[model samples]
Target: MHIRQSIIDTSSLEGQRISQLRAAVEKRERGTILASKYHTAPLKIAKAFPMGDALGVIVMDVSPGLLSGDRYELQWKIGHEAHLFLTNQSFTKVHPAPDSMGGSAIRQSFELGRNAIVESMPQPVMLYRDAVLESETVVRLEAGAVWMGAEVLCPGRTLRGERFAYRSYKNRLNVYDGEELIYAQRQVIVPEQQLLSAPGCLAELTHTGVFYAFSDRIKACHAECVRSTLEAIPNRSGHPIQWGVSLTYKHGLAVMAAGTAAWLIQEALAAVWRMLREEMLGLSPISF
Candidate 1:
């Protein structure tokens, strides 16, 4: 149990500008999140970062949220017309804490403001057997700001058959609006090299999710009504679970979907908030 991770940055300032930032869980040799609920709304300047803001910062219901030669770094900075929303309360089971060496990793940094709006929905990450995880998300936007995000992965139980026996899973998402590296997504998972049966890997998918939405004034009829409800999702067993949407460079936009578990990508994110229910202001859609 080589656990040693601690990061803290609970930003809060208004009269002088540093709105709100949070990440606080000073230090814990093992993961623990029996229960946690975070809320922000009152002029919106959210804060929480030293392992706490992003909702429990990788919490495990009772034992393995992330601990196996652990090293987690989390940071968040906001100011330019700030507005932030991040969540977490369930579905973060990365078990192996007894003394597994190659199993936990996280590096997160997000800086926004210029009309800043950050929405993070965390709660769909469960990697058990031989689990090896890597996560890196870096974002810096400042040209009339706005950003939306998501990352979900599930494939251990596979209806009891156990697919992708795990052992390794890597995720990288980098977005920069200041010097133009708009968006990037990289993922790697290997189960005996078969590459999960090739063909876009995770072919016979059991669960996968990725979503990002950047903005510079997104109002094109509400993004085509959420891209026509994410292109009318339908296929399932016969292998109809890979979806896509793209629109970047200015009013940046991105949506990628893969389904099989997490209740079919949480019912396609609840039909994308019932097809953009007035652009989700009264936000309501968080389920494990």
Candidate 2:
């Protein structure tokens, strides 16, 4: 795969840094390949490696982290029967945003052709004191398409005693099958405005993780399997971790976990991912 450089005309928006990445993957007789890719500064794909039958691509950022007024736009197009696993290099560090600009924003969209599959698993996000972030993701899946995504959120620099020091964090996700909207979720966390340690809120948990699997192949049996697997998972870290699994209204399942450590949440989500990959794709556990 060749990385194409594109120039963005940022003459209008008052010197705010805007980065963009557009990529497409297709399936051929050999295997899934990166058909085309274009990226601007602060976002690039060095190469696409093979992960068994699927293609793995890691999104890289040249900048230290997201600063005030920074915007990232990512779009992915997956051809029929293609499988792509997308991840990032490291944690998404969000620095404090100016009160005027509000916060940094991330906009991502995915278009999956028939029988296509995409797994988007990025690393955890770290919010600094007074940091603000707003993220939105939209996915459009055609017949027989499958989309899996997971996210881990960290309050702040916990070791620096900056937990819950951020100003606000907001995220919205929408998934559509053809013209029908199947899933919609909006989450907002304002540490300074709300009582995050309350019973109804995050309480004692400092980190949160969410995993979502959506496909037309999802069935009642799959939901049961996920539930049983989650129940059977042991807490070897001795950390208080809480999790739950739920089936969507149709053709989907969600796993949510909250814990004191990021690794605890990651381990729980990895277990669910392995189970789903075996039951749905008939594939072995992913190596990375």
- How many steric overlaps are in each model, in order? 14, 0
- RMSD in order of candidates: 17.3, 3.5
Q: Where's the lowest-lDDT run of ten residues in candidate 1?
A: 12-21
Residue pairs that clash (backbone atoms under 3 angstroms), model 2? none
Clashes of 1: 14
- Give one digit per residue, the lDDT tens place, for model 2 in 156-200: 999999999999999998888887999999999988789989998
Point to the candidate with the largest TM-score: 2
lDDT measured at residue 194 in model 2 versus the true structure, 0 to 100: 91
In order, the Cα lDDT scores of the candidates are 0.58, 0.86
- TM-score of model 2 relative to the true fold? 0.93
Error of 2 at 281 (Å): 0.8
- What digit string (tens of lDDT, one per residue) describes model 1 on residues 1-288? 111123222222112212122332222233221222322221122333432222223322333466555545555655555555565556766655343355666666777756655667676887777677777778778877666777678877666676667678888877887768767778777676655665765565667776677766665566676668867767566555766666665566666677667767767755764444237443444433
User: What TM-score fits each model?
Assistant: 0.33, 0.93
Candidate 2, residue 100: how far the Cα is off, in Å: 2.5
